[model samples]
Target chain A: MMDFGSFLAMGGYAAYVWPAYGAALVILLAIWIDGSRRRRAVDQALHRLEQQRNSER
Target chain B: MHRFANPGRFLRLANRIQPWLKALTVLGFIIGLYLALWGSPPDYQQGETVRIMYVHVPAAWMALFAYLLVGLASASSLIWRHPLADVAAEAMSPVGAAFTLIALITGSLWGKPMWGTYWVWDARLTSFLLLFFLYLGHMALLGAFDDRARGQRSAAVLAIVGLVNLPVIKFSVDWWNTLHQPASIVRMGGISIDSSMQWPLFAMAITFHLFMLAAVIERMRTLLLEARLRNQRLAAFERVGTQARASE
Candidate 1:
């Protein structure tokens, strides 16, 4: 098993390393969330249009 | 390829692949993160700081790869007037820009420890900065015009012209003496990096590529739907106008 303390410490470069990884994770998550929200909005709009067409018919 | 140019067909294909892509992306990230953090051994020189390469290298590669895609798509849009090409190019900009931003930030983070400074105006770094600017410029030009087609055409031209920078960025370290190291993994000989480090890097690269594809497809779908909604609203307004005229 790896020592958790040394792993976290990252050989004294933890301050530099973790934040780089953290920033990447944050950006990736943000992109995913934003894309999902946009997709949902588009789906709702399309559904409303379909309902309107059905009512007209 | 041509048949898929139809938006309906394209959306159908995008929808089909998107779920699979998402699953693969999530799986890749899980495996990649585990390997990157623990499976790989530390570098003799950089020590634990070598872990940053797992993220930085992949982001840098994607930053260039995405620009290449955008440039090719823009060329198709301008030359053949491919229906979805402009949209593809436009959707790629922000994602590519984000990758560039990540690469730059992470590079700076790595640099501070290794080089004793956050940044330097070296050949490789400066060319990469220009790439980030190109993405922003493409996006800004797209929104600058009132007419959508005109805006797309203008941006497509900009993207194509910016293609010159791609090769420059790739070769900058080789062509000029700079703080940035020259190509290691992609040179004439075999990869200088060890097998243990290589696996995690490959995994991360795959993850980032899949994530980019998913994001682009999702954004394209949204844009297509918005276009359809605009047409529907316009049609409804026309119907109302006709009815009002008839009643009068």
Candidate 2:
């Protein structure tokens, strides 16, 4: 097994490999977070509208 | 398929499938990353830089696959006027654009180490750049009009017209002597990749596919809800207007 340091070094191309993976992680996380936030906001708006209709009736 | 054209039924179906998709995507990423970083061996030519392929290749595949989906959705929206098709196209474009950006950035990172430069104006690179712009154009057209339906119709037309670029992006490497390497996995002769690399690549690809599906489904659900909100507000306004006129 390679040492932790060597593995992190990525065969001396650390700069290139790490950033590639990092960008993937950041972008994927952004998609998930933004999706969840939008869904929640819209769902809340819908729920409020339903309640308002019920109260008026 | 026609039955799913109803937004309510589609939303219920999406709700059922989303949990499973999210779970599988998370699991896939775990296994995929482990295999990519540890289990896979370094390339003889590219060395550890080969690791970048695991992410780059999958993102590129999704970028293309998602565009193909947008093209199909746009066609249905235009032809059959499938109610959900417009939502599908609109929701998927941003996700597709995100993947394209990832691919471009990661490809650039890989190129610097392997190809000895950050970028080159090769056919493959240039065409892929055009794909990114096509996605941006699609999204821009979606909001360009005051009438939401008109905006959607214009975006759909752009997506359908952009279908020509899909073939160009796929064939760019073969059609020109580009610095970017040609197909290794999907070529006619056979798969050039070894079993060691294949596992991680397939794992990541599947994960990305599931992620795309889940993201698009979530976006569609939110869009449907927003549409309902709009209609309700409009109805409420008309009701108040009728009461005022009735009193007068």
Candidate 3:
């Protein structure tokens, strides 16, 4: 049987520890994704605006 | 709010400030990480794992701080009709939700070794979880309406209502018996921790602040561009009508 102490001592509770690490990873990924999507939206909006400006001229 | 409502003006200022914000965030994170990993002594209680406080605590703080920003922005928009206040609030909502999730996850991670449980419904934890819900609610409310203005206005109201939860979350640890630890870095009685812990904590705080600034500026720039596009389309429609009348 795997001892409880041994289990926890494995990377110092890394079994439980992995969740937090995963959480942190997700948070960073969310920030990057949100920023990038917003950037893309801005680019699209600008492209449309550029087309409008030229057509009007 | 009115002062920065002009997109051209806002973009110029943001362009100048983005570089500095980037530099500050990188420098602060480096110093904070160095101090947290190497400079500080381990807790008599938590050992080296205590170092996680440097990131975990500030993120928890930012989760709350970001909402307060949303609440304030919503209030400004509702009151003064700041051109893009709702836009700002909407932009920051996802970022805030992400931070709240990080805080909850990290808190749970720290809790398992110390408290021996992966989950708890304690006051601090419960309220923080609700904080994440508030962010979701705001996001949902914003998209609920086919009319963007109507959607934005409704979300702004929801954000304002959610502001009440911030204080409840902050004081929950003190007001109730909690598995969570109390604040050591920014106590009303002054910081009770040692200098070693304090330095890294301060560094992390600065880094988080700079990170928020960079994210906000980038998001705001995107909002400005979107609004600009909208205005152009409307103007073009008006011009088309005038030419059609002239040709007739």
Error of 3 at B3 (Å): 3.2
Q: Give the DockQ (2 decimals) of all models.
A: 0.81, 0.87, 0.37
Best by lDDT: 2
User: Which candidate leads the pack in DockQ?
Assistant: 2
Q: Which digits, one per residue and each the tens of the lDDT, describe model 2 over residues B87-146?
A: 999999999999999999999999998889999999999999999999999999998999
Q: Which 10 consecutive residues of model 3 chain B have the lowest summed lDDT?
A: B46-55
User: Model 1 chain B, TM?
Assistant: 0.98
Please, what are the lDDT tens digits per residue for candidate 3 over residues A1-57?
Answer: 545564344336455444554567567667966786877878887787788678758
Off by over 4 Å in 3: A1-22, A44-48, B237-248
Superposed model 1: Cα runs more than 4 Å off: none
Complex DockQ, candidate 2:
0.87
Worst 10 residues of 1 chain B by lDDT: B185-194
Greater lDDT among 2 and 3 belongs to 2
* Tens-digit lDDT track of model 1 for B102-140: 999999999999999989999999999999999999999
Instruction: For candidate 3, list the clashing residue pairs, or say none.
Output: none
